[model samples]
Target: MSEANIDIQLLDDVMNKTVVSVEESKEKIFEIAENAHKENNFITLELETLRNEIDLVITQTDELEWKAKQARQRLANISRGFKRYSELEIREAYEMASQMQIQLSLSRDKEKHLRERRDELERRHRNILNTIEKSENLISQMGIVLNYLQGDLRKVGIALESAHHHQLLGIQIIQAQEEERKRVARDIHDGPAQSMANVALRSEIVEKMLNQNRIDEAKVELRLLKELTRASLVDVRKIIFDLRPMALDDLGLTPTLRKYLEEYEKRHHIETKLTLLSPERRLQSSIEVAVFRLIQESLNNTAKHANAKQVEVKLEFKPNKVLFMVADNGIGFEKQAKGERPQFGIMGMQERVKLLQGTMKIESKPGKGTILFFGIPLRIEENTKAGGSEK
Candidate 1:
């Protein structure tokens, strides 16, 4: 039942077999001490083995801590990588949006410019159309005028032919008169004028000799001949210059006029002034010639008819036109007096202007000076050059 009772019985049995004594008990105790020492030794060995196991566990725990830190660093790196990628995507998106906005602005600007250009072109087109309409109306009126003039001329021609046979005779008479004037002028220059120059040369030599008291009678002839030669040359030069102006052929309208006006001033003692703004640009050759002739005719009329002290001639450029104005303080015309001879100069000027489709205006009264205006409508040429596209 108990370890003590079992042990007493085992000892009593051992004693029956052999008498038990203190010496044996002592021996048994010694043996027990020896077994206890061995058991303690085994316990010490087990403790050392347990301590080694604990040290192994500690090393394992340290390895686990290191692995945990490495996992955290990897996670942080992944997160940062994600954040950087997101930032790059955002910047790219923003830049793309900015580029799109710039493109849109440029497109809008271009569209606005195109719209303005279109409007300007349309406005110009409308103006050109209006100008054309006005021109057509004016042309129609001119056509009526031309037709009326043609009819009047025909009626006048028939009446004159029937009633006035001497009309042709008068024309021939005027031509004969002109030819006679030319012949006289030519004869004066060739015959008497040349003879006078020869006489003048001889007179100069005779006069020089006479100054030395040689040939008194010959010196008297020489003096007379020299005076005659000078007078003849002056008269001949004046007449020839008036009849045929060399300046007219040599120079254009303005230059010829300048030289002619100078001569007019010297001859008539009239202060004729001129001012020109534009250089003489090239014109149709016929137009230039016609203009020159017209001015010449107008000036002749002024000199003959006008009792004016001063004359002002101005040529100016106008839009689609050119203006030539001759103003003078002179005896004015009486339009009411139909009996007076028509100023052939005025009528001729009007006819010439008509050929050019130009307008001529004459402003005059009893006291006031005559202002002859020759307004040339250069619109045809201007329109042609402009392609009729500018109003």
Candidate 2:
């Protein structure tokens, strides 16, 4: 056999083995997730039982307390009037008070024990739920890896040995793409798909109302269905826009950004300002997209974690590079603290800028705010080589 043929055979064999190993690991993780789910369910039931027991014990303790109080009052009265009561009655009253006190103490102890157990079980349940979530996430990530290995990685085997850095970058790109696809899928499922289902159900209800000669009820249902369908359309358009904003192509970067910021401010109720330091013009398509995404991610982070009420975005069109900045008056985070890395969103933004041969800087502190800066080169030839032109 030719050398090339032999190499191909070896590569195929290696890939097959790797795929099998990944599959086995995925199965094991799936089992762990399944077990964690079962444990979470069991803990939930135990928590319910413990709660009921604690309530019952509390009621019993309250009853014992009342009885003990009554017994103590009776004993005090009998001792004060010793000559009017028999010796047997006094002894009985004293014993009754002592017994009631003991019962109340025991009931309280049992209640305390049951409450402690319930608290422990609740903690365990939370831990188990976390475990289950982590396991499921791991399984999903493994599936992405497995798909990459089985499909795209196999095709890239010949180039792998030659372009090691390129291979790593390619993997990152693939993972990002997969993550984006998952986000789109989730948005559709939770938004438009659900709305459509509700619309269908409501349409049926409207039809029944019309058949029953309930004209007013039918009109109300029809109005609701129309509103739902309108909302569904809006959700779908938003998803499509997220995928690729047509405005970016038609109106160019600045206008697109202005419109986006307007909508974002309205939606998040955060005051946002956009300042253009240079003449408004378009950069390379790649640079424009990257800038938009970086800003979008920064804004999202601010909304999600910053607790900021106001944000400022600045853009400068330089002779050779475009400068972008986003600053927020939010509760910022420590940069590279003792053992923590930058958040994944920031890391991803940095990667995107790096891929475009750009520079990025982030400044943040605990009580202060955060500021991110990007300087992207406007080299036509290089950007075209990296990402195609607008046309």
Measured by TM-score, the strongest candidate is 2
Q: What stretches of model 1 exceed 4 Å from their correct place?
A: 1-228, 231-251, 277-279, 318-321, 347-357, 377-391
Instruction: Indicate the worst ten consecutive residues by lDDT in candidate 1.
Output: 145-154
How far off is residue 297 in model 2, in Å? 2.4
Superposed by TM-score, candidate 2 places the C-alpha of residue 179 at a distance from the truth, in angstroms, of: 6.5
Over the stretch 1-391, how does candidate 2's per-residue lDDT look in tens digits? 5888788778888988999999999999999988986676567656766786788998899899999999999999998899999989999999999999999999998998898899899889889978976886787699788877876567665665656666677777777766667667768968996687677667766786788999998998888888999999999999998888888888888999999999999999999999999777766676788789889889989999999999999999776788999999999987696777778788788777877789999999987999998998888664454344333
Q: lDDT of model 2 at residue 191?
A: 97
Clashes (N, CA, C under 3 Å) per candidate:
0, 0
Residue pairs with clashing backbones, model 1: none
Note the Cα lDDT for every prediction shown.
0.60, 0.84
What number of backbone clashes does candidate 2 have, counting pairs of residues 3 or more apart or in separate chains? 0
lDDT of 1 at 225: 77
RMSD of 2: 9.2
What's model 2's TM-score?
0.64
